[model samples]
Target: MLNHYSLWKYLIVILVFTTGVIYTLPSLYGDNPTIYITQYITEENHQTLDNILLSQIKKILENETITHKSISLQTNKILIQFFCEKDQLKAYQKLLTIFINKYQIFLCTTPAAPYWLSVIKAKPIKLGLDLCGGIYFVIHVNTEVILNKLQEQYIDTVKATLFEKKIPYIKIYKIKNHGIEINFKNSNYRNKSIIPLSKINHGLVIHRIEDNKLHIIFSEIKKHEICERAVQQNSTILYHRIHQLGITEPLVQRHGIDRIIIELPGIQDIKKVKKILSTTASLEFRLVNSAISDFDINNNLIPEDSEIKLTNNGYLVPLYKQIILSGNYIVNSNTSLDEYNRPQVNITLDKIGSTIISNFTKNNIGKTIATLFVEYKDSGKKDSKGHPLLIKHEKIINIATIQSQLGNSFRIVGISNLNEARHLSLLLRMGTLITPVHIEEERIIGPMLGKKNITQGFTACTLGILTSICFMVLWYRYFGLIASIALIANLILMISTMSIIPGMVLTMPSIAGIILTLSVAIDANVLINERIKEELKQGKPVQYAIYTGYRKAFTSIVDANITTIITSIILYLIGTGPIKGFAITTIIGVGTSMFTSIIGTRAVVNLVYGKKNVNKLSI
Candidate 1:
């Protein structure tokens, strides 16, 4: 009878201990300092690090007398391992001197476990930014830029529609926030333009004025939609940029209609991140206009149906007004090398963009195509001498004629170096930022501080558990020892369950959840022991008291835990970030407590006190 275990009880214990261990093993293996390299290598490069780049890295390491462990390129990341954090930093510095920003490098603390462990799909818990040493940024979006861009697009659409319908409009002028106004020579032309303009889908109000003019303005509803869409697009763009950096579990979220929040774990250098956050990069494919008359590149002259674009070199090149394609159509872009081993960006288009490119290229096989690189930076951020750290407007990076008709995919070569290729491809692949964003707030937490927080938190948790164990054992003697054992088991079960939860991040608040659950576990044990003492005082035998005590305590345990479970679920549903972490830990801990308090303690009590001849009650 003492060894009795229903099939369910046997299954529960096995499941808890076995799973708890498998998920917890990775954390115990410890961490090594590794360098994460985001090279942005595209498939078009048709190259791998092991081919050319790896050899160069190895040569540098060997010359510098630096030791390394396993080196690999996975998930578009170059992970170079080292035995000590000191060596990792040393190697990182040495390599930076040679490469000079060829890649985005992160000196990260990576899992020191063997390849076999990773092959089996075991990973350590993801810690929050505060617990792992990282940077936090609160950025505010420029919604006015989004509105003006939309209005410019609408103006183009209205012009094209009037031209297609053969409606004679003398001129079209933009009226800022009021939208585009068109002047017609006569009332007949203005009335005719109205029917064609009615085809606009994005909620525009068109009116005819006494001056034989037509005005189109965005409706209130459309303006709100544009604002919402701009914020969403900026969030999405920022997400891609973060992912491209190869940072794990970095948080990119919308804070308000015009604000965004970014949390990057293990990033110490704030200066390296500020430029990427503030600058907006995009791409344009326009036809080269070589027939234009040669003019002074810096005269600030304006030409008809053409624009002067400053190339990466000092010369300004003329380009047609019509853009053949834009970065918005690109679904993916990556770094690669050309036939000459020169760095290049390979771009892949979405279905619609592919069709547009296929039709255009098919018609103009010998035409020259120019790839214009555009970057918008904040003018307010300056260097020491009051000069802008970056050019505040668009610059054309490269231009080449089409060799043959092509579609779907193409490579942009002539990048100055590998770093340029990586950066250009990264920006192209990430699409465009709908508007500029300003960093409203920024914070950096060092790794030493994060480690200290972890230490103090765990020390507090351990001291609390140890103190509880001593109290339970001292007060109730033998039965209290059994409760202490169950309390240890409760801790183990709670940790194991949390380890297996997908996307569960451990924060300081999560530790609080576990501490609260430990108290609940102790309360459950107290309820059970007191019920047994009451049964014995009523003159019940030892075995009968055990049975009645468990039967009486089961209802209270379920009722107490279930109410807390419901509240935790509600908190998890409404909460975000750290609050969700706390809610999750609480939910898992409550279930583990129920198992350890009622079933685990009872099993030990049965083994020790199952004899029928027992007369004296320990409690």
Candidate 2:
């Protein structure tokens, strides 16, 4: 009984090892090359893929003699799984060429794990960008646009304040470089307006420009604060959007004063990813200017406070400049079908937006309202400082008459297709970018390089493990073999834990951590074996020596592992990117190694040499 384990202890060890193997089995299976097809939403056209489109794709593949595993329809998209990467690439090229304007295509990979394993949600450990290959982007946020917007907002504020204080002005407009200029009828009115404007202390610098004008500009400190805030806000928004895409371990961080660096590991949809990241789209609800007839619009009689925008059907409609609601107030949005089975976006607004919409709808019972869709896009032209210029696009997506008082929840019709509706809903729900961003640099890491890195990492891990096994066996014989087995179990348990945990990514540094863990496990076994040898040399009996060796070695093993676990914790807390990846594996590996090296090896040793008749030990 000295070295024997109880029934419950044996069962616990068996259960843990079996569970580790079961979870590790999923990683042995490979991934299938696949193609994902969705509607390419554009300003002029949006169309979802249907059964007809699926048939067309199938026909095209058959005609080209491209072998495909299966073709199926998914939510808002179509998926085609192929047996190999060659066929996947060929099919992607063929489909893209034929449906260039109608659909967006992406080359991707999905798990080929069996149905049973998938049912249990078993998955392989995620690979990092360096190992799995993905798209890397360097984005430049346009801080100047934010400044311009702030200045425009301040212009309204100044106008309201001066008017309320009974100050007269001839005209107020933005200056050529920065800030705003207000021209007064005379010097006295401008001087009188200065005091009221000074009360709005939002970092505004009010200067008397000549006798009858005042020039207002943001102070240097205020401009810097605005730029920093915009960059930080954009970074946060990008993080949310990337996570919504279901990408794990994406890197979204600020690089320079106005630039963001993003690394999306294992992502292959370049076009869709770019659209989601760079497109600054928002919605504005404005009341329709019903007084402006079409005849007057055609003759260029648009009002000063109203602008004419074209609808989706190519008809021009006049809408008031005042916005009743903006996308910023939207808390949630989803895609749904309307009464006529047309695609629509269901929206839920915050309290303030709800109040604004309710008040407006209550006052104008029969008045018409227009939904203005706005986007800022790169114009492919750079400014003097080499930054891309942005073009603001606005269109009336929908115009509807008020049937009743509206509140927090409503649906907008006139979306071209389901895909478009989904895209709009995703953007609105994730929130819009504060300013337009352009891709300053982009790099695509091919799967070939990724495969090479993975191969190298696998080779390194296997070599390290083999070396550790051979050394342990040659030194301690039978006891060394038990330690080797425990070492292997430690590796399995570590990998399984990584797979089970969310957001654990395997990188080159993680591989190094695994190798180090194997050494640590071997060290623990060596300490126990040496202790047994020492006890036997001191003339202790065989069973007593074995029990005493394990008992004496437990404290040293725990102390060393505890120190390592603490160090790993500190690394994880202070590190970023690759360092974090390494730290995560080290932490998990150290924990598993402690269990295998002490508890697991002991279980096996007790079964092998825990008898009263034993007189000598192999180790």
Candidate 3:
């Protein structure tokens, strides 16, 4: 009766073990090599593939004699399963040539788990880049561009303040990397402008260059703050974009002053990745220069204050240089159809942007405003510093009259098709980069290396677990066998818990954590076994020794595991990349080990020896 457990306790242990085993089933099924083909929208053409396109792809594969396991169609995408990676690669190259500019084709692996397992939301543990093999990118942010933009804004502020305060100045212009310079007629006007200009921005350091000139520059602290903010903003936007792509466990983090390191595990679409990461797409709203008539446009005559921008239809239109609003303040966006059944992007702005747009539209009703779509592209040229040169591309996406005083929301029409509309909406919703970024370094880890890593990790784990089991059994006899069983259960429970937890990626170091956990679990059982031996040496009955041994071991086990959990948590909080992955597995492993080493082994021991009236123990 002393070593016996209640019916409810046995049921709970059984239920937990059963659940662990069930969830762990999905990982054993592995993954299948597959190719995914999705829609790729361009400015010239924006169309989604249909079943007809799927049929054509299937026929092309057949003509090429490429063996495929199955071909299926999903929403706006097609999937082709293959028997092996060779077939998958072959079919990918074949389809990519035919659909080069139209469709996005990429090779990836899909879960081969049973339908029933997936229906219950059971999934395998996510693997890190080192384990799964993918792309690594070291990107450099152009902080100089951000500083220059800040200088321009400060220039605008100085001009606005000078005009408002009735201060006279000859001219105000930016002095490249230094700051803004204000030329005045005399020292009287220059001295008068200093007070108001100094109050414009907290970081501005205003100084008089001469009797008729003043210079304004940002302080060192302010410049550092601006650069840090821009780098952090770029990192956040990149994270959002990668998440929208449905990538799991992507590593996007700042490396140094102006660099970001990104690890995309199991993703093979290099072109798409570069396009999404490097693109700084945004929108600007400006009033169209209606003063220039169609006749002036035909003669290519443009006003000094306006610039000619080509529309998506290849027509040139003049727009004012003043921007009323920018996409930086856009909070949300979605693709929708207008009243005329044409594609449009419905945008919702933040409070500041909403107020700006409302006041502007209220005062300038009936004025034509143009939506400018802007993007920064790599020019295939490098500067003196060996950095890639970025060319700015601007197009007039829409030009329409202000019909009403739009508040927080508005719609832009003239999108070429639904696909383009959707693409634009996605970019706006995910937020735009604060500055341009170029790939400073790129490395592609092939699937073969990943496979080798997996094999080595598996071998290490199997050997560690088997060695632990043998040691435990040789030391404690039948009780050691019970401890060994509990040890194995700890592993299953750990893996299942990792699978259930979102964004938990398994790396090589994670396997090391698993092995370490097994040793700790064995140590716990050894404590119990030693305690029982001590109790038996004191002339105690077998049942009394068993119950007292477990009762005394509980304190030591909890204390040890609690300390380990705390250490793992600290590592998790301070670590990055693979260190975090290792910490995560250790925390999970310690938790599962606590449950299995104590509660799990106790249940098995009770069933084996609890009710028996024995004069001697197996030990």
Candidate 4:
């Protein structure tokens, strides 16, 4: 009983906490300090629009004493950069639209860089793919790769089993058509291998041929494990990559065995995301043996193309191929400017990579490297003279004095702009952007779509409850009215639970979960009402029947609901995304339903039973 009360108290606490949560999220997320808003006006007469927006913003910034700059007009756009607060976001939107009725102005917010900045008039409440658009890539994990891995695992298991019994096998590999290729001299061991392995749930479809090769077809279950492993590996890789990208709450989930879904809300530059995802980030450092001309680098004397492209700076690079030294090798990287005010990136290498780099540099200390090839490309066409030509340019420079205490750490000099330096650092960290992936499926909901979805979802929920309430009153009379009241309280508890729970995500699927809960709440009431009718028909007194009906229903309701809750728990443990959402709501709803139906409805029923006489009861 104490545990039950504590649960109810928890529900109440959640309710109170949720009201505060709803009010606080907008402030925390909306008033982010790093947002910049810029407005583009293609035509005239938008000066008044700009002034009005400035005034509204100025009024809001008064508390912070943040002096509002009058909007600055550039070539095609008027830029406004300020920290936005929650209470002011709605008003800011209204101010921007004040001249929408008159002027032909184009307004848009750039996707914030590195997932922190926003270029909106306000921090957008509903994140859209356009405003926060990034890349969406789905790689079809090859089934053949999974099968091969499984085959290797099976082969290892078999080898261990055979070696224990003093049997020897030449080699093992999975045959393309279907089965295992095992070349063992002993036929007795091969026959024995099949019987024990078959019983081990390996799910191999067995086919024995007269030849040495044993044909095996993997069952759906066995094949599925391969795909599952691939998916898990991909998810892990993506999780690490997203962390490297420094994105908060990025959606990295497996859609199926072979497909993954990634959502970087408020990310701009889909191209950048694609580049980041496709890079393996494999870093290596090789000695620049001798300065080579661009012509030699491009002419296939070098292996594959390198990833690096030399700017004005002289250094050896990967030329868009795999990096010799990746960000992983660098224990740390920082940004600085050179003496000429040009941007430069400093990187500190890890112990191993540093050792390799140090040794390589030490070995080539006195080499006067005149040319360091940064980029090599197949020109593919002849010059104006029409002769077959491959253009190669030498961008590598002579080696400067190498610093000894610096270990493997080095600096890239001569970046033209701060943005360029930043880009270079990112590319270096990402380990060269070669063959970057592109967005396969991009779903962007604009502000208008968000509003529509919100309106529709709310309307659907309201109508569902209203309809349920009407049915309950019409059918069960006074007791039904009591159940209806309980249902409303149940809903409040659901909202409160969702709002206050730390890991809960109130997604579209969660709304359906709530509605499903409402249905279950109604079902419990129906069960109680029917049980009451049964008691009254057996000649029990009105009050006695009412009390007995609830008492009898309580055990059955608890038993049934407990089973449902357990199932939902199992689902939650095994599922992901929307499935988990459904499971979560089901669990919360079932627990809450037991309270409102068993306690809340009973409380109201006791009040009604007290008001009525001894012998008459309305169902």
Clashes of each: 2, 0, 0, 20
Candidate 4 least-lDDT 10 residues: 38-47
lDDT of each: 0.77, 0.85, 0.85, 0.56
Estimate, for each residue in 1-619, the C-alpha lDDT of model 1 and write its tens digit: 5325566875777676676667677766777778876553322222234436776788888999999986776776678889987888999998777665455566777777667768877677767776778899988887766677677667777877887888877888989675888999999888877877978864899878786998889998988888888888888888877776666677787786788889887777676577667767778899988777565335645444477888888677888767778777888988777888898889899899999999998898888888887766656665573433434477777878777777899888877887778767766765677676678789998888878878887898899899899988888888888898888888877765665676677778998888888877899988888898999999998788888888899999899999999999999989977788889899998998888888877766665666556888676
Collision count of model 3:
0
Which is the leading candidate under TM-score? 3
| Selected candidate, larger lDDT, 1 vs 4 | 1
lDDT of 1 at 253: 79
Q: What residue runs in model 2 are displaced by over 4 Å at the alpha carbon?
A: 1-7, 43-45, 55-65, 158-259, 265-272, 288-322, 329-356, 363-368, 411-431, 610-613
TM-score per candidate, chains pooled: 0.80, 0.81, 0.86, 0.52
- lDDT score, residue 610, model 3? 85
lDDT of 2 at 316: 89
Model 2 lDDT tens row, 1-619: 7999998998999999999998988888877788877654332345656898889889999999999988998766788889998999899889889877776677777677787998888887777777878899999999988898777778777877887998989988899656899999999999999889999876889999889999999899988898999899889888877655444467787886999989887677777788768869989999999999989899999865578998888998998777778887888898888889998999999999999999889999998999999999778888999988889998888899998999999999988887778778867866778888888899888778889989998898899889999998999999999999999999999989998997677888998888888777789999999999999999999999989999999999999989998998899888876788888888898889989988999999888877658987777
Q: What is the lDDT of candidate 1?
A: 0.77
Question: Where is model 1 poorest over a 10-residue stretch in terms of lDDT?
Answer: 40-49
Clashing pairs in 3: none
lDDT of 4 by residue, 1-619 (tens): 1112344655664464355334333323432312223321121222233556546545655644554323444432334434343423443454446544432222223222223323222222333233234344554433443465356556556666666666666677667744567775666666766765565455777666664445556787777775676567656666665555444446677776566778665444454355456443222333343444666656646532223444255443433232234334555555678888777778777688787666656765653222132322335664463333433344532234443433766776645566545544543543332212223465544444544655676687889899999998999888888889888778766665554565455555677788888887888899899998998899987777777787788888989898999999999989987789889988988977887887777655654555466676667
